[model samples]
Target: MACMPDSMRARYDVVIVGAGHNGLTAAAYAARGGRSVLVLERADHVGGAAVSARPFAGVDARLSRYSYLVSLMPRQVVEELRLPITLKRRRYSSYTPVADGGLLVDTQDDAATRASFRRLTGSEADFEAWGRFYAMTAEVARRLAPTLTEPLLPRSAVRDLVIGAVGEVAWRSLFEEPLGEVLRRTFADDVVRGVAATDGLIGTFADVDEPSLRQNRCFLYHVIGNGTGDWDVPVGGMGAVSGALHDAAVAAGASIVTSATVTSVDPGASGVEVAWTDAAGRTRGVTAGHLLAGCAPAELERLLGGDDAARPGGEAPASYPEGAQLKVNMLLTRLPRLRDDVDPVAAFSGTLHVNESLTQLQDAHAQAAAGRIPDLPPSEIYCHTLSDRTILGPSFARTEAQTITLFGLHMPTRLFRADPDGSRERALRATLASLNSVLAEPIEDVLALDAHGAPCLEVRTPVDLEGDVGLPGGHIFHRDLSWPFAESDDAAGRWGVETEHPRVLLAGAGARRGGGVSGIPGRAAAMVVLGSAAG
Candidate 1:
């Protein structure tokens, strides 16, 4: 209900809900095609969950709070939208801690990687397995990634494509079994297995051996991004991506009104009626030819007419799809000194993994599933300031300041549901302590304090994510990210964003092949609207 007052157009060709990155993309595409477009956002700004903002009081740093790093955004969208964003790849992929020196996956040098693994694991078995596994995955990614932008491929067809690329052994081991089982079977060392398995549990919290293979879905998206699976750093933080999309939207003649939270959407044969509340609590309404639910699919259904809001296709939504990750953003005065002898800059530049050996990750999941927060939460940390100093001000550059984003895996939303406030405090304590367990000194030692003398750290629990970002249960993908292939006959031939309603469509992460800040669903949704006009 909180919003700034702005006069909305009485009629438009398209009315897109939720002015997040996806919404903006849809608006730009729709308007560029000569359709009168209106974008309605609930928040005070654009970039719903993918925004970069200053969290701490009196801090000059702009941190990527919710969604950090870029891996899945396609070059096609960037070129088409004329997005002015630069993504940089880390020379080192990941570093895992062990007894003496940690295991570092240096992307630039295979000899360095081999030396690190051989020194840490005492053999080249897992490293060899790691190479073979990625090669197979790379082939699968090459065959599958191109299919995402087209009409949904049948699951069997996609399976055949994977089999054609990687053969029966990989398909049975990777697609059939749980990702944890595959990692366990492939690698000789526990640390190496954990490193590979971490990809499967990024935004998901489940046993690697869980029968559902939800972990497999997560793993596929993590690696298949651009087919190479390399997570890259945005040169000027995540805000650059959002800002560029916003510019493209504006240039395409889309009217974006912020602080305008959409309250209702009614679809009809003729046109759709959209209603909302302004900043002063005044009610307002508008109508558009086509309605795009640029928010979560479930949120769209809720806005469709209150009690009459039927589930799309009458399929009941999941009872409680909870996101299982904790995002912690901190402005560190200096990088923490690691137990390993590598320079702090080199150590923090890549994924600085903590307490995520294969058995240890499984133990954390067991503890969390049993309703107790894991004593030592599994997490991965990286320093954005190391790659892009633009996020920090001149003062920061002079002081060599750094921004560290630590994402703790396996912390589900259910754990914090009962005691929301207390759980955050306890979870933050546990996660920080878990992090300190791996560091030479407490991480708090080098943190820049706020004016109030509190450490410049902002902890966003699943509860906070659900509350602030309008993500139901703080589920980052809006719901479980579906396999890119089609699940139903109705959705097989059309754009993935199509809805049961003739004029309503999904343009957010809830759509199939929707996750991260990729904007694939937005592009798909816009194609649906524009395609109808051309037809």
Candidate 2:
């Protein structure tokens, strides 16, 4: 059971919907600015998709159930909010196994990485090309990352910044060409191409040559994080990240109401009226000067009477946004041995690419788009315990038990819509098989059992995300990611969080430059209300 705030009032200076990390960020900033703020969440707790849980009955290991990894969150937000959070950098970057050996990217040791590349590719060409390509991206990331925290710049301004930082060729390759085309042109080896292309297709369901440039947008976000593009694992799982934000918001005097389902939102001349059904089934309404929707654009549309034309991006398209990935969480008794000589700690510490070669990824996407699960689903595996063992309980922490999270590409909601249970089971089997292909033994051999003697493994498909997290069609970015720069001249200088309504703003992943676990949109929205462009 949940209860409304003890000091609930009839009105607030600002009202934010959804108590996810973004909503909590807005509440903290708005409240710290001496404004009365209220945050309403439909779930009983905070941290929407970015949460930690002990799914297995009687298990003490806490896993980042969804939205694992921290990137794109600006250091400014962390410093300003005084968040007690630590992000650990993994020593090894990634390891993609091949038939003979494997390509291991050891960030701490370039010589070892070069040797691994030479052993796998039989030359130094791809390794040198890799260095040059990322070097170009590093310059671009350094120049463009800061702009994400600022007001939207015109397309030309951002382009000029990239062109100045890197060169015309770098700009054209990253911004103008399809990411697939760029990858194919940059690398000669298929495995190398796949490794680079995976960044572009993380949560996106598109081929390298998809004309829409969706992969390009996804690739851009992946590389521009904190000017380094290195994805860090949050200490103590993702729940800690949300927990810190929740505490900050509460300390700043924001009123948070949980299990409060917002029913209606009416924006008018005076202010915005928001009505919700509380945990007690009692309807409550409040008015605020502004409403920050920290939810999907589609959910916002539904609250406003299902008007498709009123969405943030204008009229609804033929279909809503759909998330195209499968997330699997597992607890293992001990790390599995690899077929290659590389240590398990090195391979699983970072990203373990399984059957994600460029050609295989393209084939998988085509198969999924054609309404069948890919026979060999491409997936990446990560071991949280290798980077940070704090997520495990004391007893488990002292042992060899570990947490493995597998993210599969191209498992869209459409594949599971017809028969969710059937498709999920199928997808899960296919994904595990794909992973097993590169392992010394079946992964099932090392899976730890819960108290009930059941394997401690759980899977979440896009359809599952839609039901559990309120993501429309389970689209992870809330919608297709927009270019960081303004799409049109008129939109320049705006926060990129402005929606169709004057008094409402998008404070979620749907906002421009909004995606992943970054609280960027929430921070930007608060800046808009505070009349500060450079907050």
Candidate 3:
């Protein structure tokens, strides 16, 4: 039997702050475990960063605004929750343009893909290398997928596991070495190398030679998602994923409160007291057996009041992440014309890579590292309405309406912090101009205007994200992604969500193997609570 949300009884077994997918997921698991759960969200709607909305006024299209695509989410979470989610396969994988006819990676046609590679690189060896590299990643995924859900494996044990699964050669090449050097070593052409390395630079603001090898971590997460690394489009936009999770948690009898801003948390040996301001601006406090931080670690620290209470010698304070991606969602009157003979439908159907050649990518990174947005912003784009037409309103569909979401790489938060508006405008101009260099027509020519008579470009710089969605430094992953393996003895063989504080756990992107739309962190956090109860 589920206890109703009673003001008289102001305590719950679990109080999860932030109703993002991860928090909702944790709430669902806790509720299913027969523990009273309460989820507090600052926004009126749930689904934190992963959400869909009509950003432009008077626009009928629903765009997957902040976090788009479905890659890292595991099927186990969906099955366990019985979520009604649908994912559509992109017919094309990716298309990168070059001086030649350009490279098209088709999901179904191997002959076409090989030919495209041959056309772009003019080498049969490069085509074979591409196949071998993907095969290696596929094998790595097969071996590592199960480990993500389990307790953290020791670093040495994880190394051995990788060696056994793929090979010692791959372990040294992909895991130990930097991704940039690995790509150069694997591919013959610079364009091919650049395309392959784009995964390594999704949100990370590092080059291949950086000592931390954070790019490698970023690459591993990008490729190993779902054990196949295939990024599928969710029907009904990203909000559907959240909607399903919200439904599951609610159905499981968890109490969810919206527009509730958590003010502070006082953790004790027996329980935790959480204070928050409600939508009505009234202060409310509740006690819970455990408190989960679905926001960033820094936010969690603030809620705890300070870092003074942190375990003296625990893992170094969580790194402040600087995101290097700019998201632009637009309603297109029609797909932009392509430079190559390829149809815009085919190009936009999947990931459309623009100005992302090897030398270009490296140059962009160098420029951005030097404290300037790249002159030619490397980017990739995809049209959501092509796969899921339901996001388009009936009347708007008559206008041949579509939604294009562009993700520009290497635009770190630092670039936007000094002058938010000016930086965003400059980035948008540079990004679109860079995009225009490859297109037969300017994308601006194909955009539909909002009611306010402005082009329907809803730009989301890191600054906008930080203010609106509460991602510190606008980092999509909450913090730098931790290695899947335990880095120290204290963290060994434990659920990766555990923190220095015994009763507090990370239910968001700060946890190990935490990135993308995957609810792995959320599920792992709940398991820790459940395990403690069992013990």
Candidate 4:
């Protein structure tokens, strides 16, 4: 624990703990609304999992270790914030390599994509049907984006009525319907169906063919932006996006303190007392009218003294069943060689879903659910070098290309017996071996692999237990996206940000609408406070 500065004793309107993207956004909005705000971060850096790290000595590159892609971010936030777009922004184009040496690529251009699908399935009608299904699903995704990003409390009379009407109209047709059936109705081609189902299965413990899994369609709202159908990478790296947000927050009159770990939060009647430690060995406390937590709900619970200290749950927190994600980042001296028919550039530009059949994906999920690492996991690889040549020197002379490989539905972090030290190395080796099998030459010599298991991730980014990079369930969309809103405390949207605890509001990803870099929760919290004062 470090000491606080002698001059840092002023009382503020709000105190925010954690400087992740969502936290930063919240701070920015709170400050803009005429409230003095302070942001505390445990790590020396503030990006959380959205950071750029130098994997190899003297090599400067950005890598999104836990979260590798961004499409779910709202376009409104990007425009209002005027975020920089230097990174190689590409759509979420995906390629699934078949065991028979064939490839299926999903593209935004419906006709061209249909042509490709027909080539793979040998049926034009099937291909066209797949296109229509995606188009329709995308429409649903667009409609659902608002509900996810903003707080949807139906507790108020008018709000409840409005919500009821919307729910009746939007979900009446799809309610209780299985996601696979929805896909089946949308696309006749198995390849098309597999791609749509893949989106629902990844990052979740749900089966692709399960009933009512169609709720996952809201996650696809990333497609709402640009309608281009590709997941874009930030220029320079994922860190650039967070870096920009941090700068924006600072510019908006918010002060950020890095390497500051908040140990306890005592919620008083009117304000909250926050105890934190800085880099140097010292203890300090700060009082604020409102306290917004951007860390995990569990971490917050622990900080507030566990269940005994927590206010009774208004509703049960959404169930984010324990699951694990294994990420392997590799620095290769030479570009990986693919089959003659595959374009290395296109393969690396967007996300590549390997072993991408419905059965393969489901089996991996099953293995993960059962607390076992799949022998052949379904992996998604993004080759940064192919898409952004700057990652490598103009001619690849001394430059090293980076690849981010994600292995989902594998080894549950809670069930794994070995320490992360050994587990990470083993996972990296396994991933490299798999890549080696597909490459023309041995890649062992050029491989500079950095593997992250549960422990490493917990240390680097503690928000995974909360289930998301946005701290407390990487669900950037937050409570708004949780299903069956009627049964959860999240449905009330009375997230304490605007209640009688006027001085204290919940601003982090754990608040009202929940996570993401959108900064909506932060802005909303500020608005609530400001509007109350005005009234």
lDDT by residue (tens digit), candidate 2, 1-535: 1225645568777889999889999989998988888899999999998899999999999899988898899998999999999999988889998889899999989899999989988999999999999999989999989999999999999888988778899988888899888887888899999999998888888888978898999999999999999999999999999999999999988988898999899998678999999889988899988899999888888888876543323433566887899999999999998999999899999999999899999999999999999999999988889989999999899999999999999998889877889999999999999999999999999999999999999999988998888887778898888889998989999999998788889899999999999899999989888883211
Computed on alpha carbons, the lDDT of every model, listed in order, comes to 0.84, 0.89, 0.85, 0.56
Number of the top lDDT candidate:
2
State residue 227's C-alpha deviation in candidate 1, in Å: 2.2
Q: Count of backbone clashes for each model?
A: 1, 1, 0, 25
Instruction: Give the C-alpha miss distance for residue 354 in model 1, angstroms.
Output: 0.8
Q: Global CA lDDT of candidate 1, please?
A: 0.84
lDDT of 4 by residue, 270-378 (tens): 6688899877957778887777776655556667776532222122244532334455566665556665366666665676666556666667668757755565666
Please provide, for model 3 over 1-535, each residue's C-alpha lDDT reduced to its tens digit, 9 standing for 90 to 100.
1223678878888999999989989989988998889888888889998888988888888889987789888888888999999998898988887656788888799898888887887778898999999999988887777888888888888789889878898888767888877888899888788888888888777787677889889888888877888898999999999999988898988999888889899989888999999889999999988998888876788788876322212222445567788999899888887779987788888888889987888899999989999999999998898888988888777767899999999999889877889999999999999999998899899989998999999788877877788887778887777777899987888988887888889899888878789999899999999888631
Identify the leading candidate in terms of TM-score: 2
Number of backbone clashes in candidate 3: 0
Off by over 4 Å in 3: 1-4, 307-319
- Report the lDDT tens digits of candidate 1 across residue range 402-516: 9999999989988887887899899999999999987888999999998789999998887788778878767898888778888776667777888889889999999888989
- The C-alpha TM-scores of every prediction are 0.95, 0.97, 0.96, 0.80
Each prediction's RMSD over C-alphas, in Å, is 3.1, 2.7, 3.4, 5.8
The regions of model 2 sitting more than 4 angstroms off are 1-3, 6-8, 307-317, 532-535
